[model samples]
Target: MNTINTHYRLSHQIQDEAFILSQAAKCNLYLSISQKSIRLAVMDTERNKFVVLEDYELITVFTPMQVAEQLRLIAQENPLLQEQKWNTIRLAISNIHFTLVPETLYDPAHQHDYLRLHSDLNPLQDVVLAYRHNSLEAINIFSLDASTYQALEALFPERQLQFVHQTSTLIRSVLHLAPRTNLRSMYVFVERNYVTLLVVGPSGLEFCNIFHYLSPEDFIYYIIFVMQEQKMNPEQETIMVWGDITHDSSLFNILQKYIRQIKLGKKPSDLEYSYKFHDMFEHRYFELYSLHLCE
Candidate 1:
């Protein structure tokens, strides 16, 4: 063993005064796993409030297997993860390999086929999964690393755990926040290596896709390309952004240079957060907070 390498760091941790290990059975534990971080939020479902939040940033992990190892290491010491019972448990895996198909055309048996149309799937390493967005009336077909999936399943044996793609949570949160106006609104969620962009029209979600970029130039290029393709006006339409970005960061600066309307996204408003959470940026951890909306 490599001693876990000090490869991960706890970036943010807040627990409400009401959070008690014994009361976990009345809370919902939400976990969001991505390439760079693992975040968990404990929502007191009985009170409709969030009581605990933790974000761990992985420093040395580059592969899913490595991430899984870090997860195992963290679970050993994290009391929340050690707890076996919660009102519900939801795990959202974030990645670029996912496709959203309209519910009317979705077939459970062809989940792989739906995802294959967008990315190549490796049967040995990837496990195909689908999440139904009842409100959106769409099905998100995605793949999770087989090893990580099994690790999570083994962690909470006999308990029902719902697994969903991170995009599904993002979509649910965005659609709920989207205004019922005729103008198309663009939303972007930034990660270490990629960005997930979603366009919401008067009716519903009009466009959703992910783009990988290497530099600030590449990042702005994708945003502009999506605007032109969607016939959105860069000078007029506003774009709301969330995740891994700061107001003075190069990414945000570039976005401002090209798009006239740029605003940082807000935290999910459907649920309340503990007073301890007031210090953290509202825009950060949008997906982790959105997991509460997942059903």
Candidate 2:
């Protein structure tokens, strides 16, 4: 069951028959939070399979308080989210104000300083956080609205929450899924109005950035521009795509017009999914699923 209100709209809800509310303590809860949307995913740790998934498309939520209020409304409706305790609670924040810094250069004391270079973060309004990438030997520094962060804290007051940047989760999952070779490969995560372009190399992530587009032309332009900057041949190098796009989408059609090889990415191979998810697009909710890979 789902509902659509003035503040937010429920877009997808999938659950396995085996999911039991009484056994929620044995499951892990993951949430992907942003101003545009909030997604909830539940994984049964004992079986290592995802049992529940929900996506809410937020509307006109531009301020921190607005986003926080929307989250409260969602929690009120989602029974799964109403559960306070779980095996683990992971929340990923999505925003453009994030910068990747090498682990060697990262200083926890100056995390805010690092992010300041990329965005104008207000000390009173924004909270700076960092997620370390152990495998990639890098750190992702990002900002979250202080009020929104506090709202999450208040909601799960007793539960220990693990916060991570959306890009960090994407990077972690892509590395594990990308082939280990010297050849550079590009992986794209497409969302409502933005696309995250990542180029993974043999050793680690070569390039990663988010681009906002107003049109299909802007979307393909960024993709092609990044490929050119990386010196990847569009004819030879293949791009694997995931997220809220379809094969018939104008974004995909334009992508096909320029790039010779484009492949739709599959769900993480190491993880299992419930049969309820079989009918859904495998590429969608990738970052939400990748939360399992986040530390």
Candidate 3:
């Protein structure tokens, strides 16, 4: 429940009084969930743009109840969050499992495959099941803790809450942001214990998956394995990375040895941000910011 990072952008000229909390009514509210913290953003439909509002990073993992309470406490502390109505979209990333089914063979009734694939790693006793259709890629069938879903729902009982429970939010975020070119590219989003690998070929999304690891050894192993299994030449295909990692990290060092091209991902260029975002790292919030673009 401890916040390790907080950033707010409000113009001194207008201040908080002019920009009322209810302004969120016109903006698309996005929340990205994780074990360590929750990230939020607001997109103004009128302006067809978005701004990175705030992020809450916890000091330690909190239970589902504690997570819900922390959300309440944080909202109470912010004037903008006091609004009674906000069009909200919650994107759960942590403790989520997803599998892709080719559209040609996709069937809505087969959603149980999502829960079945990862049942060993994540039990689905009280988990909510959902799916999203990717026109260009494939159907993403996914699952998340039902209690966590309830926790989020409890936060905004009065507002319209549409859940963006993508099986791989990081990959979907990168999918919309990354370029669509002929060059085979792999977008890697590294979290503390998980890494999302999305490979985009000239045609479309060739491969997209998430792998869990405990050490740098395990991280690189999975990366290399994906490349090898997909027949992507680590020496030629480009790899762009974002999230809780740096170029100096051991993971990056290992990746550099096998992969020749490595680029750092930046915030999605489509969104407009305030001057406050100018000082933050461009690579930090790809997934959270992507929540605004999630369908």
The model with the greatest TM-score is 1
Cα-lDDT of candidate 1? 0.90
> How well does candidate 3 score on lDDT at residue 258?
80
lDDT tens digits, residues 63-116, model 1?
998888888889988988888988899999999889989899998999999898
Write the candidate numbers in order of decreasing TM-score: 1, 2, 3
Instruction: Find the number of clashing residue pairs for candidate 2.
Output: 0
Show pairs that collide, candidate 1. none
Model 3: residues with Cα > 4 Å off, grouped in runs: 1-19, 62-66, 79-82, 104-110, 120-125, 166-168
What lDDT score goes with residue 107 in model 1?
Answer: 87
TM-score of each: 0.97, 0.96, 0.82
Q: Report residue 239 deviation for candidate 2 (angstroms).
A: 0.4
Residue 40 error, candidate 2, Å: 0.4
Could you tell which candidate, 1 or 3, scores higher by lDDT? 1
**How many backbone clashes can be found in candidate 1?**
0
lDDT of 2 by residue, 196-245 (tens): 99998877789999999989999999999999999998888889999989
